[model samples]
Target: MKPADIDEFFRRLAADNPAPKTELEYINPYTLLVAVVLSAQATDIGVNKATGPLFQIVQTPGQMVELGEEKLRQYIRTIGLFNTKAKNVIRLSEILVAEHGGEVPRKRKELEALPGVGRKTANVVLNVAFGQITIAVDTHIFRVSNRTGLARGKTPEEVERKLVRYVPARWKPHAHHWLILHGRYICKARKPDCPACAVRDLCAYPDKTSERDMLEDPPVPVPAG
Candidate 1:
């Protein structure tokens, strides 16, 4: 896409949602980190369902450690890879307590050093929790970025680098959330809702869904790719 179209693309998204936020529920940075970890292969709604009660009981690393891995597993049992996620959560909490004084680190390197926290997770924590202008290229953001021709890349890391380098500074803070919401609701995987998409005209996707397809059947839900 041209520079002018790229600017307009984000402008429409930002205009639609002046303030987009993560669907995951959290009380503070500690809980935000945990929520992002739990959301690895799960839906935000699912993670929120589990974390809603978990956060009410444990908001800090100390509380999470005291809750223990076994107990944590019980809370997140519905989520995929609960056993592994539980262990990482406990281990990360312990590190936070021991090294960062129970606070989530602001730096990407330190955040990634924690168990189960990868680049995407660190970017999310940095952007949402710390107000840093970092884009976390999850499945949703990945699809929207490529489909809209805003920043096409074969890998998440490549797309993320492109977004950071190209996206306007004014739109950087909420870019992730806007793209995420767009993909989740409109530019879906199975069949994008092109008719309802705000940026359909600006999108570079060649195989746009037709009005007949939208009327015939709703798009099937697919796992994020």
Candidate 2:
């Protein structure tokens, strides 16, 4: 997409969701960090399902340490890779209590230093937990950026770099949420709902679904994010 179209693309997305937020539910920054770590290979829906009750009980790092790894496994057993995820959650919580005075670290390097927390997870925490402009290119953001010709790249880091460089300053704060939500509901991986896409005309994707398919198959009701 051209610079003008890129700006307009984000303009439409911003209009659709003036206050976009992460689908992951959490009580505080610590819980948000844990939720993002758990959501790595799993869907937000799945992570939220597991974290719903867990967050109520373990809202802080010290509480999580009290819960312990073996018990944490029971809470998140339904999520994929629960065993490893449980261990990481417990260990990271322990580290937070020991190193950060029981608070989630704001620095990217400090966030990434925790177990199960990578650059993407750190970016999510920074963007969602705090008011940061960083965009974490998950599968959704990666596909949407490339598909719409907004910021094409072979890797997530490359796409994030391009988006950071190209996205206008005004839209930077919520760009991550807009792109991720658009990819999830409209520009889907298997069959994008181009007929209902607000930025369809601005999109450069060649394989956009036909209007006829909209009538024949019909679009499912998109759940509220």
Candidate 3:
């Protein structure tokens, strides 16, 4: 997309939702870290359902250590990788208690050192919990970036880098949430609602689907904008 298109695209998104936030529910950075770690390959709704009960009882590293791996599995068993995730959650909690004084570390390297906390998880925690501008390119964001031609790339890292370079500085803070929500609800993988898309005119996907008649076209300048 051109500079003007990219600028207006994010401007409209920010205007629509001034203060977008992660769908995952958490009380603090500690719980946010755990929620992001458990959210891999799972929906926000599913994670929130499990964590709602889990966090009530185990909000801190010391509390999580007391909860134990076996009981943790019982709470999150409905999730995709409960067995492994339970083990990692407990192990990381112990690490936090021993190393970081039971607080979620602010630095990405320290967060990544925790068990089961990968690049994406660390990025999410760093951004949403710590007020960082980093983008955690989840599947939804990755798909949207490629499909919209907003920051097209074959790999998530490439798309992330391109987004950092392309998106205006003013929009960087909440850009991740805007794109992710848009992909999840509007620019869907199966059949995009092009007619209702905010950036349909700017999007360059060749096969963008729309509910309108094929012969009809959206308003634009004659031959050029």
- Best prediction by TM-score: 2
Indicate the residue-level lDDT of 173 in model 1: 88
- Candidate 2 regions off by >4 Å? 215-217, 220-225
Q: lDDT values of the candidates? A: 0.91, 0.90, 0.86
TM-score of each: 0.95, 0.96, 0.92
Candidate 1 overall Cα lDDT vs. reference? 0.91
So what's the TM-score on candidate 3?
0.92
Q: Which residue runs does candidate 1 get wrong by more than 4 Å?
A: 217-225
Candidate 1 Cα deviation (angstroms), residue 64? 0.6
Candidate 2 local lDDT, 62-120, one digit each (tens): 99999999989998998999999999999999999999999998899999999999989
- The number of clashing residue pairs in each candidate reads 0, 0, 0
Evaluated against the true structure, the overall lDDT of model 3 is 0.86
